[model samples]
Target: MSSSAFKSSERKLEAQVKLNDYFQEFHEKFVETKQAFQVFKTKSFFYPDPDFIRTFTKSIKQIESEVKEMGGSLSRLIGNQLGTHTQKTVLNSMEDVKPESHVLHTVSDELTSEHADVLVKGTETESITPPVSEAGNDDEVLGSALVQEGNVKVVDVKKKLSSSEKKRGRKKFLGDNAVIPKRPRRSLMDEYVTAQNKMKSISEEPSTKEQEAEYEVQTIMDFKKSQGQYFYKVSWRGYSVEDNSWEPSSNLTGCEDLLLEFYKSRLKQQERTKTDDLNYQVMPHDANHQHILHKALFSHINNPTQKDYENSITLLASPKPPVLKSQKEIAELADKALSQKKKDRFYSVAKTLVENMIMKELTGKREKQLAELRTWERNMNSICSDPAKLAVENFVDLELPPMDFVYINECIAGEGVTIPSDPVVGCECTDCFTDHKSCCPNQMNSWFAYNKLGRLKVSLGTPIYECNKRCKCGPSCLNRVVQKGRNVGLSIFRTTNGRGWGVKAMENIKKDSLVTEYVGEIITSEEAERRGKIYDAQGCTYLFDLDYDKGDQNLYTIDAAKCGNVSHFINHSCDPNLLVFNVWVDCLDPDLPRLALFAAHDIKKGEELTFDYNSGLNSKQMAGRLPAQLTEQKEEGCFTPEKRKESRSELILKTPKGNRGLQYVLNVSIFHNVYQ
Candidate 1:
């Protein structure tokens, strides 16, 4: 054969080898997936599928067989080009490239009984070296003998120190959180010691004046980029253009949601401007038609003819004494010009000035209706020491739950779910919030048991709903508690129970206090089901079926399994301090109500926060059991959307109408630890 032909044949062989490696890798992953599924099947349900092991094994063998056949075919194609000898050599090479099958044994061991030999022969692992027995039982001899056998290891266990031995000298810890445990009961002398060590925390709190001022971010006036830092010229609430000051990103601190909203709005505005510019064809200037900006800004003026347009430009172009106008005045004039966008280019050449004029968000009424789209709560990586291991994206001092997280602002309508348009044209009273109730569209009427500032009056099971942006109530409205970001201190803790992880209160939480909003990617039922299978195999599911209304058949689900907030850390408890509520704000869509988890009763600091999976309703009916699927009986104040197998009396008492069906029939056995 010619040299070129030989080189071509060699390239073909290389490609065949690459294909073989990929197929082998895929075959191993397939085996692992099969093993994972079998594990899930056996452990997830009380009565696991009897034929699961047989079926899984069959599937794995079939897939591996196909992979081998594919590799063989590729080998044949390349081998035919060379001679019969080359083909035999290639086939021989394939025999040596077998992937390890350890997963099969691991998965099969759990399923096997004394009578069943589930593990196949040749796949079984045996000890490479036989177990050695020492000639003597003496400790020194055994230890020496183990050392002599290079394969054996002699481990010397260290003796633990007693509390008394360690307490002889006072020790200092390196970490900031290190603390010495104290007795529960303290005498008068202990109080003196405590007083001597305590520092005044009052000086650390924000001043009364500062707290009273409702600060909000409206417009990003200017952006300054520095050597690793970014600063924004912010317009504070109740402040004018002249009073606006440049603030560091740190000063905005907990208001990351607002900053993200500002970013998204700017992006949208840029997109709209591009669309607007695209809509207009770049035709040669029609002198008769003035620029759109000029026309819109000075719409009060009469129609300008072609000659009059020329005169306006001439007057604007004329060299006059430069006026010392303030930035606020310039911004105001620009705001007027660009704000009134009636697309009749009054001054065609004033494109530069028009581009510079931006309408900020934090100004006037827009600041009050805090419903804009936000991007991030905060950059988790910047705040967290390790972000990959933590399930959530926000900074939490403790380890997060063993789950995935994705951030989202609002819940979207899932498949088969319908968002009802039952928006109450709420009362426009500025004092409705001040009074802690509203008569307009009086939903579930005995207004929520919240204070004038929206805090819970006492630990009660009443649901809380804040006045939406549609209402004329101001930002400080008492009904607007949930929207104000995380108000109570919370910590994501690793649960001691088999329930994985959960959230705990860092401070005492009153009854009806907002814990955290159950935020995550709002996906459709189809997408949810597709993901459900994968999550099921992994043995952890965070998909929540939204049943805020039973009238709507379209099932909606929030799959917080992947993307979620701190609420994902709140685990299920049969007797729970927290309860989930369907809160509607912004647009009144019945189908896409926000899942707000509030305290059902007062919670002590350091206590784990939990809510029943389906909240006193049957689990199968709502399919609300998460991760570990366990069916539970209904409890009192069962406010879930869908109720299954209700008797005639139960149905009559609990209809999905307004406040008429809001009565609670309390149950006693609700506090048991039955929830998983």
Candidate 2:
């Protein structure tokens, strides 16, 4: 082959290679630009609000659909170019290479636009010059001539030529000599190539900002659903427009760790505030027991006695005489009874009648007293009030003491307060009645010995007695004998060893159990004080020893010493097993007042019964108020077990200095038997 031909062929091949490089570069840039746009569109769609997210997503989808169509066209154009390159490479060795003018024109038109905006004004329009044709009619000559110079080597050569030709064609077709306006100057490939490069850079860079924005938008959208609020302000790590500074965004939603930490801190603050509020209130007190006992004792003292009233009558004269001799005798006796002066006769006859009525009235009075005593006993026993059938009323239920501490014993009549004679038969040496003094001691054999006034005196180890009274052989006895009746007393007595004796219950008793009820005067603290002051003003000797506090001036007066009862044995303990309860003994019959003691804690069998003396008493009075004791450490300690135990031995008693002047003395012993 000739050297000139070979050189021409080599130049052609080089030009083709340059064109392929530029096309490949342009295609790559286009792909990069498309990818960057896709990322931007995706980021824009991620909005916080649900409504906004929907709108943005719709817009992005529309743009993406358009881009996909454009991509298909661009792909086909790239395929065509690649096919032309392949054909040239394979065919160039066997035949004279020819530049296909029609193919070149088509390719050029596709690569460049006819728009005048991209061209440089006044530059030579050589690209538009007519294509060189072969001199001979042979196809080989045309193909060889077109391929000879390899002038197609210029990058984007076809594009530049097509742009120039279109410009020239427009001017020629107008047929006017007028010069066309100068077009703007720009590099031939600047817009397309530059855009492609910018796109590649964008696609290469990480989509961090995009992803963050998308997450924020998602959080905001979910916030309305999860938090149920509108217009939430989101904060995160980003540049702030307001401060023109970079910092963490204030709003954080997706991170659960921070939210939980914030909530826990708030809860702790609330708890601390609540605790502070609770520290500023005061405690309460209970005083039901003392109130009831006071009422019972007071009622018994104030009630009027039967001896205080008079009982006599006189008759008017009659005109007719009696017919029967018996009637005449009765009439004569009646006249004799009524003959004395009005006042004098009334007194004499009433006195005679009272003495003669003793036996008959005694039986009736005894029965009446017994019935009333039993009723009073029942009231004293109950710790709580009965439940009402009506739902609207509220009742304070008393909590009772456990079983094994309360006992009831019958009362036996005595002489002028002396211990009554032995009512029970069957006696022997003291050994048979050891620790049962009621059967052995002649002085303390009666139940009446335990009764002081209307109250019963109870002591530790007091013996219970069984009465053995025989019925006289009279009408009543004969009737009882016919019925096979036995003569005996169900009453029991409390014994102190085999020596002293008192009344006691035969059966086991429960704590807070009702023992007996004593009736007395009931007065308020203020009333008692007023009465005390009145007594003092009247120069009554009994009021001289009364203790009065000027500030409160309240006092409690009891006839306890005179009317001591089994209820008196109950002692006070700091840590007591029994509770003294108060009840309005007769709300309907307020004249007969009473009080009761109930077991507050569990009581054991045979355990000395005790209660808290200062349970409801104010703290000021509790100190130094217990009974005196014989202890070694009296000066240093506030209280000793021995001293405390000694207080239980003290008995509360009444004196003549108005009931309020009474004091308690440690005459009775509680642990005497236990120690002995």
Candidate 3:
């Protein structure tokens, strides 16, 4: 064969191979779509929700688009091998129709095994007769296989299917049924190419941004000015340099510190350049000039007393009268005069050097602190499962990190304190909330402490009885709230108002939503008293007494000063958003009840979390000052003791005495009553 003719035949074979690949892909996708629909139907029958319905609808639309894309690719591949007229006909027919409806079903029925061979290998005949269909009204689907005589001729392929030949759902004709013969197995090279094409298509598909929204700005890489506007090239955090983007200054709203630092460096560069240029211009080129000045300055700096000055003046007598004085004495007086004139300049340079050294030390310390805090932030979130992240921020001072502090998820038993790890008794109810009297809550003579939405319903100081490990209820049971851990997002940040470090809500929280459990070292009252004295002297404390009963000394106290969770940093407030409630899960000991903090009222994002430290939960003074809703719940009234115990010092992030007194809150709460 001639070179041109051979190339044309080669192209024809390649196109046929690609067409086979499209057919296989279309068949696979069709199966997936069918399976998805089947799953949707099953779910709807058992448990239906609007969200699932919307999701199914979305998936259907996406599948429809994907099918259309496959059809277009097939059309393009066929068009490359066939003549122009035939190509247009096939492309137009499949553009608006789905692959299953026309593309694959039609191809499968029309293209026989003999015809497929004829497509890959050229024929010698000039003119080819089209196959006759049993039904005269059969429609043309694709161009016929090419005849490779001296002149090529394309015939029309038709689909002759009657009503009885039609199929539905998964049983529809996929061009791979037993009735139709299979084409010869593809060559290894062709199969490899087909696999590569499939992978390329998959990689090109768009992905959802469910993992992360905004890319973190690692640092500003470069800055530029264009048309009176500044743009910063940002190096995205946790990404490579290739992903860096040029963002406008307005786009970097909260990066004021980064921007200012960049500008400061630029300013310093300009000043340094100016200084270098000034020095270069004034510097003398003469070999002896620098040596003479260095000698004079060194001499004057070492000693410039009255006697030396008088002697130098005497050596510099009038021209004819001082002929007796040596030339060395004259030069010495000139050196002394020059050094005296620049004495202030020497001192100024020395001062600048010292200031730069100090600034460098301070900058190094700040960077070190930042690195430590970033590490702490990573460690804290690594142990948490909540979607809301804990971020540490301190733009305050070079305050040293809290010493001997350890992050704990659960409370630790200290000296003379024991936590009940296993439950002795629990409800066997299938649904804890459904059978109230037979459930765990009934054991305490109390109803479930949380509602269906997991918000607290009982009044302040009421004990929360949550389902324990021994319960037959599932993880989603209505009675399980405090054991679920923190649901709302919180951040540990330094307050500008002298409050050392405090926790704040990162998202909106509803009233009575479970915030976080106050975890710390559980110690006896004696240990607490001994530690309290030391903490008081240090002007900081973390002792929270579990004094639930009135007119009684507390048996257990929680000290969060050293070993604690995020709640360790929570400060005290006169009117706080968070209220502490005694909660029981596995441990039913009333004296050692778990302290679960819940929101007192609705709280907005960025609000500080705090609780009353110097007063009891049942104190009338605090009750009167609290929100009306907190004090007057319909289910139960706030517990009031006949006589209140002395307020135990609460946990506070190490700050000055005046600053530690400032209170803030985290937006979180837990339900107090379960569903009926």
Candidate 4:
């Protein structure tokens, strides 16, 4: 009760007060945490509803906010208590006061329980659950409960039972009374046992092998029907009694047989249809008699032989007169004329006469017809020479010589020269006769010497001759005739009477070298249309100027012709060596946009130089119209020589030995010395 005792008692009382306040605050926080935890648990179910996700998230956020607030409050309270204790200690010599142990223990216990509840709720919510709607449905709840018990067997059985129960009291119908035997409700284990027994019975059946064979056959047949169609097949595994495991069936070898059977059946069906079609087709005898009679009667009325009758019919009908000669026939004649020697004149005259006759026959103009024919003949000759003229005009100042002066000779029967038969010596220019030693001694010497050193320049107009005797000059005397002029325009090398160019490539060309320039009028679409009329009337070959760019300067333009080219002589292959790319020679200058040929792809020394012209140029229609060789049925029919030649050309051009619509030819310059 003295001064010191009184101070001590005051300090004890203050300490006790501080401890009580701390306990109270801790208890409040613990209670709050416990309440939050309980709320979280109530929301977190085994199959938590999706709708509750937002609510759950909100609750968690709230709990976190409360925890932070509580922590701050606790720290402040602890700090204030410590400060009070320190002031008391400083004012008087006394020990610091501690919080109540029981209070701390209670707070710890509550917090631990709250934290455990939070973890439990999190885990429960995270587990797999039924969809939102199903989770809330009583039926789903019942089904889930049954499934969890491992008592539900087949899904079909459960569904059937569910349906029956739904309709039980609603219908007293006769169908409902026609009792479907009630599926005996069994535990999953019991149902599995039953299934195993049935499977065993099926496996042990005497006809199991036969059934398996039949199933395999059926599967194969079904597969065959679905060859080009998409489908899926179900495979079963064998049941293992010990492990309750299913093993896939083994050695499924009958699939091929089934496929063969299917194919055989399909083929038979096709054959049957073909036979029926043949039977239904008009017989040759019947067709011939009817066609001849029809032609005779049609001719009597139309009278194609008589121009007056044709013109009268045309005037009455006001229709365009029919062409007397087919374009195909004219093209054939032109090709033949180009190919022949002495007979070349005959073809030209014949083409002109035929064209004139056609015009006369169609128009039925008797007067001044001869004069018109003469004029047309002159025009036809001029137009035909346009390609040559264009070539010469373009190269006039290009350090190149005229094409007429260039003489080409084939090296045949060992290095001797074999002059071309066409252009027939005396036909165009005066015939020059020169012996091997006199006219072309250098050429003769070069052939005789066969030297390897230094380059040889063969001029355009050098005459070639074969010599039976060896040259007087030694092999070292390197003398070769330099031809007078340069050969211009595109020239193709082809073997005589061969389906295509023979095995050997033309000489004096190198790979990746410029071959020849295509020389033609750069006509606009309108111009082409106007000029195309003459070609159409004469049945001469012409090309259409197709606008590839449609105004886009970045793209290329193409000259597309309905008629074929030597490029068309090249064939199509799934695998091809040559590729075609448009090359502009003068890239820096726009005005000098000349087209130059480069190797489409790399070529071996002797390989044919070919390209897919259709590449980057074909329309969708053209692509689709290409024939499928595997699918087409071949038939015998009468064809003109032109058609036969075209067919042969196409066959040689296409890959895998089949008829193709388009043809392409090997560029001779791929093997020429100039290119090399």
TM per model?
Answer: 0.33, 0.18, 0.41, 0.17
Kindly list the per-residue Cα lDDT of model 4 for residues 1-676, writing each as its tens digit: 3568756655654564455445434533433454454455457533344345557546655654454444435434533443475544543543342223222322323332212222112211222122233322322211221111223322211233476664563234214433332211111111222333343343343332243232222332222113232221323334222322211112222243433343344333433453323322111111212323223222222323454443333332232434455656644443443223333343343444344444544343422333443443344335432232111111001111112221112111112212222221111111111122342223322211111221211111111221211333322233321111112223232322332321222333433333322223334444445556766686533231222212222222222232222232343434434333122211212211223223333345445444333332132222332321112322222111101012121121111111112333323232232222
lDDT of each: 0.44, 0.31, 0.56, 0.30
Ordered list by TM-score, greatest first: 3, 1, 2, 4
lDDT of 2 by residue, 488-573 (tens): 11122222232111223333444324433222233344545566666667653122121222212323332232223343333434
- Window of ten residues with lowest summed lDDT in model 4: 389-398
Candidate 2: where is the Cα deviation over 4 Å?
A: 1-50, 58-74, 81-201, 208-676
Best by lDDT: 3
Error of 3 at 334 (Å): 30
User: What local lDDT score does residue 436 receive in model 4, on the 0 to 100 scale?
Assistant: 24
Q: Which candidate is the best by TM-score?
A: 3
Instruction: Rank the candidate models, highest lDDT first.
Output: 3, 1, 2, 4
Q: What's the CA RMSD of model 1 in angstroms?
A: 43.4
Cα error, residue 229 of model 2, in Å, equals: 6.9
Query: How does candidate 1 score on lDDT?
Result: 0.44
User: What's the lDDT of the predicted structure labeled candidate 4?
Assistant: 0.30
